[model samples]
Target: MNYLVKINAVKTTNELEDAWSNEDYKALLARFEYPDAAQLKPAELKEYLFLAISDFEPHEAAAILLDYKCSDQLVDGQIDNLSHEMLRTKTFENYSEIDLHHDLFNINQLLYSAYNGKFPLGTVNLVEMEIKGDDNVEELTKETALKALSYGLSENNLINRLLSDQIEGHKAFPEAEGIVWELQHKGDDVYTLTISEKWLTKTEITNPEYECTVVPFEEHQEAN
Candidate 1:
């Protein structure tokens, strides 16, 4: 089945930088709604920016960040400061397997907390799916397919590997047990993903599994 994965969140520094490019210092200060934004030095400005956007949804914060324009030096410095601050507040170091799992769950929660629970934007159907197995091919509901794709993509290893790869065509990911993923480059900053999973059998339990396609959020929106 074909699924459309809408990436509603900005995950990289470069992407954020590319989204907005106005470097007017005064404008940057005004955008964040700082009362004394003009009086703040670079360090103070960075701190205020963090504080100002602390309560914002990730997408909203991201949109504001895209609108930001400042000198390259200042942008780099502020982004570095903000990134450190964000990680410090938003993530914690995991000391054990349980802690790691907890942290992963938190990350998932944070992703969902964006834009009224439609965020980190997992997979959704562009068309109906057909679950295919050795001797059976059955129509899968859109809802079930979405859940499966979302769960599959939620695996950290799978997502990390998928985003990191810049090459086109079939790729190998030995660490992502029970999951099979393929990439087809569509254009600049856009690609199609085909992912399949059979990890349920790891517990010696058999279940139906299916393949789905994913594309950029913008493309998916345009198609609709």
Candidate 2:
């Protein structure tokens, strides 16, 4: 039986709750001919429940959990995090290899300049580019290459492809003015890129008033 179809067919929360209570859900799962169904643990069953309700493909959901090395005791928060990652995966599903390579070229160029030519080109893989501003650092998988590509273009991310191209020779010197970029080697093909503002020049601004009026309560009441 189609796993998603079967699970989704349970139309009501009450039905699902009752099925679980009566072990009817086990019978439903048994019909799917899942490998080693009898040996499945509570955590695995909970993951299956999460997958059934999620928007991702069953195989994709399973793969994501496996890649993250989720423990036997899956929780709601973990499922939520997985869902977010899956959304990023979907967003970049159509990202082409050519575009990816182009971005990679810029990234490698920046890295080479940052390391003073010591870092070899074409060594950084898609998985090595870390996403910025995440609460927890996630080790991206090959399937999440598109997510990396998207994050790489942002100013907050490690790659900062656009910023790298704008700087002369793609080199970020310590004494550079304006925004300063820094690269740190985090070992075993991992690198962290960060940026900070320095000697920022402020621009004076004036707000021009548009055609507008703030009416008093008495005038507003009279108009109404």
Candidate 3:
């Protein structure tokens, strides 16, 4: 669990300064909209920016931090489905976990939240060990274990399947568990692979088709 906190602090300070220079912060509040940078506590502002920084150009990330709204609704810590202000209200101070899988920020947001005790931006974790008859020591191992429930899919089984024939030669990612067939039909050969990061599993999203979005573990963080 490598933690990165300094960068977030710097970004937050920058946003606060921007809001101070412009009346945008006051105007946003007067409209009953999300608070602007200056209105945000530096810690909260940093978490928000961190959550929204994935797949964004450096300048774009900066712009978003300066202009977006920050509110509790926008505080899921994921950048997707949020206006600038909505994103600003996210602070790791309140949330126990941060999800950063898809709503935005990808892995970077997760990394940021991990340091601050917020959940990852877009992931959920299951207690594989506490399923049934498991010992405490074994349960500890199971914490890192992955299971498909129905097919008795374990992390090893999942990875082996991908290695054998499932993913078509795409290498298994390091922090990722294994692809789980979330939905499967009798006739259709398609299944949704439940991808996950180190400590959290992403919530299943309906893709409406057979396509799988496999982002390389390295590229899964922030796009260069």
Q: How would you encode candidate 3's per-residue C-alpha lDDT over 159-183 as one tens digit per residue?
A: 4344432222233333222222112
Relative to the true structure, candidate 1 reaches a TM of: 0.23
lDDT (Cα, tens digit) per residue for candidate 2, span 1-224? 00000000101110111113214324334433334545767557634433332444443443333233323434566445543443334211122222222222332232233333432332222112323323235453221222222221334433234333222223322222112222334553344322211111111101111111222234435555
The TM-score of candidate 2 is 0.17
Cα RMSDs, all models: 16.9, 23.7, 18.0
* Candidates 1 and 2, the one with greater TM-score: 1
Best by lDDT: 1
User: What overall lDDT goes with each candidate model?
Assistant: 0.34, 0.29, 0.30
Candidate order by decreasing TM-score: 3, 1, 2
Decoy 3 TM-score against native: 0.23
| Model 1: ten consecutive residues of lowest lDDT | 10-19
